[model samples]
Target: MPYRILKRKDLIPGQTILMVVDAPMIASKSRPGNFVILRVSDKGERIPLTIADADAAAGTITIVFLVVGKTTAHLATLREGEDILDVCGPLGRPTHIEKSGPVICVGGGTGIAAMHHIAKGHHQAGNRVVAVIGARNKDLLLFCDELGSFCPEVLIATDDGSRGHKGFVTELLKSRLEEDKEIAEVVAVGPVPMMEAVAKVTLPFGVKTTVSLNSIMVDGIGMCGACRCTVGGKVRFACVDGPEFDGHAVDFQELKMRLGQFRTEEKISLEKFRGQS
Candidate 1:
């Protein structure tokens, strides 16, 4: 069955489509950090997106996306009440949450949507949640106000300091770690480089850190080897094993290269499609 687009918004100048899918059961099972593979048309490219929001009773799930390629650009053309060809799952492992001392949640770019559930979980578990969200600029900062509701303290950072601190989220994390030595766990989700930097900052201090990874995933279910990563010097598949991993142990340099593999092609696709529009 097709999923009806309930609403669409320009979240941080990109596209966020809130679709009411037919899979009521799937919506009920979704958790934070989990994602779904969606196809806009019959021949559309399958894209993996973190489940930003969901309501079981309403049988809806919101997928927030940045139009980065041909598929996403096509998806952006969709309007409310339009139907999508396919949307599968509630996939990937959810972020682990516990009342494990003070939790500082960091999110950047579109990763803030993924971090939303983790922050919500931490807050519900009675942990003191500090959400440090950053974007390139004020316009890039999405969900700042929504995420702030779950966090006791919400720190915003931007490269130009348009709306928050005048530095990267990693810089904010460093200052906070120095000021308060009680942040037991840190969850950083964003671009690979940002997550890597956060991992580096927390490594020496022995601060337990975890990161949400978006490795190359095809099926989003374990059938494909695309989402593979090395952890503890062993191979791990991100789809089945985790979209989350210990930041300190992850080989971020390798991950960075893997993500960069399609940069040239992706840029061309985005440019071509943007030109057509």
Candidate 2:
């Protein structure tokens, strides 16, 4: 069935778009770390996006995505009241949240939106949630207001010193870990490099760290093997085993190599698409 877009907003005008889609079943079933595979048109390739938020009572699931390729560019053109050709989800394993202690969630770029849901889950589970989010500048930051609503501490890092700390999110996280000895876990969702940095920062602290993988996916199920990655010296599928895994155990080098395998083709496709448009 086609999913209707109930609302749409440009979180970073022309670069990032947020959409609230009407998908009651998915919304009700969705939990932290779950994602959806959507198609803008019948001929379009399916792309997986993490669910930024879900309101079961409202039957809506929010998705935030960066317009990095042809598919996302097309999706950005859609306005409120339009319909998505297909949206199959609440896929992947939900985050493992339990009342342990303070949990720090680190996010960069568009991943801040995805981290919002997980941080909210931790908050609802009675865990003290500390959100550390980063962007190039204050204008590029996202979900600060929403995260601030529930989180007791919302720390920020901007590369250009536009606001908050004038450094990387890792710097804030490292300092926080040093000051808070009782922190139970650290979760990161963002670019591969950022997640890698988070894992490194949390390593010496002995805090359990989780990182969400945004692997390239074809089918939203394990059958495709397209989202396969090595975690803890074993092969696992991001779509089924987890989109969230032990950060220290993941093979970042392999994941980074795989993510870039199609960069050339993706660029060509986006260029041809733009030419047509």
Candidate 3:
């Protein structure tokens, strides 16, 4: 069955889009950190997106994506009533949520949407959730209201000094870690560089840090060696083993290289797609 888009919202108007899709099976099984691989058309390339939110009762799953390449640009053109050709998921391991002490969740750019669900999970588990999110400016920030609805403390940062802290999210994170000695863990979801910075900030404190990696994925299964990354000394597949891993152990440098491998070709493809449109 085709996955139908039930609702659509332009979170950033042409830059970021959010879709609530009707996919009962995937919604029912989806958890924080789980992602779905979808194809916009029969001939389109498969792309994996994190389940921003899932409502089993409503039989819908929310997906938020940034329009960065050809497939995403094509997907953004779809309307609320359109049908997605195929959606295969609730793939990858779920985030490990426990009733620990305080937990800090840091998100940057579009990654705030993905971090929202994980923070909700921690809140539901009776753990104190502190959300720290950042963007280039107030206009670029996302999911602030959603996170503030549940999280006890929602901290924000913007590079242009248009919002809360006039610096990076890591600065707020470091301050929080220093003040709250009871912080249990730190979870970060965003660009590789942001995640790397989070890991670095948390390292001195020795706080357990988890990061969600956005690797180049083909088949959303372990069979394809495309999503492999080095965590510590071992190679792990982001699709099957985890999209989440110990941030301190991950090799962000290697992940950055792999992610940029297709930039040249992707830019050409997106240009051609736009020309056709």
Preferred candidate (lDDT higher): 1 or 3: 3
Scored against the true structure, residue 264 in model 1 reaches a CA lDDT of: 91
Best-to-worst order by lDDT is 2, 3, 1
Backbone clashes in model 1, listed as residue pairs:
none
What's the TM-score of each model vs. the native?
A: 0.93, 0.99, 0.99
Candidate 3 lDDT tens digits, 139-206: 99999999999998999999999999999999999999999999999999998999999999999999
lDDT of 2 by residue, 125-213 (tens): 99999999999999999999999999989999999999999999999999999898999999999999999999998998889999999
lDDT-best of 1 and 2: 2
Worst 10 residues of 1 by lDDT: 12-21
Off by over 4 Å in 3: none
* List of clashing residue pairs for candidate 3: none
Candidate 1: deviation at residue 68, Å? 0.6
Tens-digit lDDT track of model 1 for 1-277: 7777877777645544333455566689998878888898786678888888878898778878877678888888888878878888888888887778999999998888878878888888898989999988888887778887778799999999898799899999999999989888999989998999999999877899999988987888888788889887878888889989998888877787887888898888778878977
Error of 3 at 86 (Å): 0.8
Can you give the lDDT of residue 54 in candidate 1? 78
